[model samples]
Target: MSKTIQMPALSPTMEEGTLAKWLVKEGDTVSSGDLLAEIETDKATMEFEAVDEGVVAKILVAEGSEGVKVGTVIAIIAEEGEDVAAAAAGGGAPAPKADPIPAKSEAEAPAAKADVIPAKAPPAAADNRVKASPLARRLAEAKGVDLSAVAGSGPNGRVVKADLEGAAPAAKPATPATAAPAPAASASTPAPVAAAAQDFGIPHEVIKLSGMRKTIARRLTESKQQVPHIYLTVDVQLDKLLKLRSELNAGLASRNVKLSVNDLLIKALGVALIQVPECNVQFAGDQMLAFKRADISVAVSIPGGLITPIVTGADSMGVAAISTAMKDLAARAKDGKLAPQEYQGGTASLSNMGMFGIKQFEAVINPPQGMIMAIGAGDRRPYVVDDSLQIATVMSATGSFDHRAIDGADGARLMKAFKELIENPIGMLA
Candidate 1:
């Protein structure tokens, strides 16, 4: 019997995706666990694997096809020893596979290769009917370049204009035979460059947005428009926290667990949420839901936009544990290798732009998350100590809260608790 392969949802929010590339071709032999293709979802580009062992009969959807809806038939597989041509003609819903592996694992499994967009190979004759934008096709035709021999840079491996100028010379067509011959230049004079087609106008370039970039813009815009935000700002001294971190790191040097300021801040915010439970909440349509355990979403910037990977049960984890977990999450997040659960659903978020020397800024709340704390750079500034002015290292932290879910007093109280945790240092351990 022939088996149909449908486009599986790569993430909980995935509706459509770009078929980035195919790992196998018609008549290829493969095992159940072998990779078949790469799928580009809004969150990441992930590898898709085969669940049923068979011969690759046909590839229905061409590589680089974009906006492929979930469950769309992409390929067919014929059972071993069956004719590949017969299976190519067979059609129906990809019936349930006897393989015990769950369908959810199709997207949830760790990728064998972690790159979001790996270097594309110039298409071959077998893949000549590649998925590409109309513009790219026309440009390829005009340049006497074969679309099959050019690597695509657009979404889902679709060839774009940038590929024309940027593709290796060896991949493009030979220079036009009828063009005017260039005059040889002497050592005193350099040959003049030819004018471009658009030489009459100012130069500009167009950049197509990736799936991840597009989603980031849409979600952040919607959040700002619909969510009523109340922001509270505070300045806290960091000297005590710094001193405590140094002392702790020296004592635990043998463990090889070095805590970052952000890691400690995560612990502080997690503990603060537990102490002031009123602030640990999400805004539902009719009512607010308060959570018992604090799961912190720490924002880490990637190539396209920002992603807040969750630290599950952060309030219960020690600083060393948080450091180790955070490092792993950040590394994987950058590589587009994190699993769905690793980056989804959080009660609150923490965004730190201090690394870029930002003084302070308000962050839009990612809903159903009621709040996000924005951290600024720690810099030296004058402060009052027993009414005597002194210079100290301090940072401005701003908390953006959903007014519908939390009160101003409660928001202020949460900030006060966070301030105390950083300033006193010892309180975070307690």
Candidate 2:
């Protein structure tokens, strides 16, 4: 008998993953708790451990294979006294087919093992007729650049976008607003381009999307198209919170705990959610799911896309604790070493682009989560206080809520509660 190893759902939301590497080859024996492979999940790279000890009879999925679906048989292990070759042949099922790319004329180009790696440039053109990609040919024609003059930079003397870097882009001819629309060249639809024509004459490179980027695109597109989002913006005074952070940092300096603005904001949002439970809910097709605990998903931008690492029971964790936890999670996230449990299943999210100096912006909701708070940079601004105008440090925050689950009034109240907590500073702690 053989034991089948299926591609794992590393995160709760993970439907597929990139089989980044195989730590063990065919015929290698692995014990329980041993690291078997590195699986690149939707958010991070996680170590896949062997749960049952056995001899690796076969690997159905190749290393570096992207978009491996969960529950698909990826390998087979021979049980004790079992024939390795027979077990390998008896592997559960064939690898699943990858989801077909959306029918927007597929990019006509040779895809590398991973991202499109630009081939190193050759010393000179190999042939009289310059070998170039369809996109390169179109671009060179449009720009009137001599293809022979550009050196080959892609595999096998092929001229790719990278070779055009020094060349100028073709400018689009102007069209007056009053001009009539041009008709299609043919009555039928155009065939898919092996390489989409690039109107630009300038040399550029097309980097293929990685697994993470693909998932982000699909999820965000679905979020915008399906979710009924209503945004509510509020201006919050941050002077109190700033002071509290400074004082807290000084007191905790000996203990080596430092708090960031985002950490404090995470606490405030968590408390606010608890105060206004009506707003802390998810739309479950038929009804709203009101969560009891406030688990905050703090957005962390990684190499290819953004991920939200959760702080479970954020309402119960102190500001200092949140800071420590967030720092650990963020560092691991960047290194692609986070566990599935560390980054999944949060009630709400908080995205702070303050460090990037963004004034304010709205964030898309992660599916199954009701809301996301977008935080902007805090700076000195004129405000009315005590019947007098004064300069105070203030920031604009926007909340994007799922209208299906949370009403307009509840959304507004959640924003008010968040603002009050930041303004008072002490309310979060209490």
Per-model clash counts, in order, read: 0, 4
All candidates: TM-score: 0.76, 0.75
Superposition TM-score, candidate 1 onto the true structure: 0.76
**Residue pairs with backbone overlap in model 2:** 108-194, 108-195, 164-203, 165-203
C-alpha RMSD in Å of predicted model 2 compared with the true structure: 8.9
lDDT of 1 by residue, 300-368 (tens): 999987788999888888888999999999999998888888888978999999999999999999887
Model 2 CA deviation exceeding 4 Å by range? 1-3, 52-54, 79-194, 197-200
Specify the highest-lDDT model's number.
2
Worst 10 residues of 2 by lDDT: 100-109
- Model 2: per-residue lDDT, tens digit, 63-172? 87665668877788888888898887774534333321111312222233243344454334333345666556655554546666666654555665557667865444
Looking at model 1, residue 219 earns an lDDT score of 84
Cα deviation at 21, candidate 2, in Å, is: 0.4
Candidate 2 TM-score versus the reference: 0.75
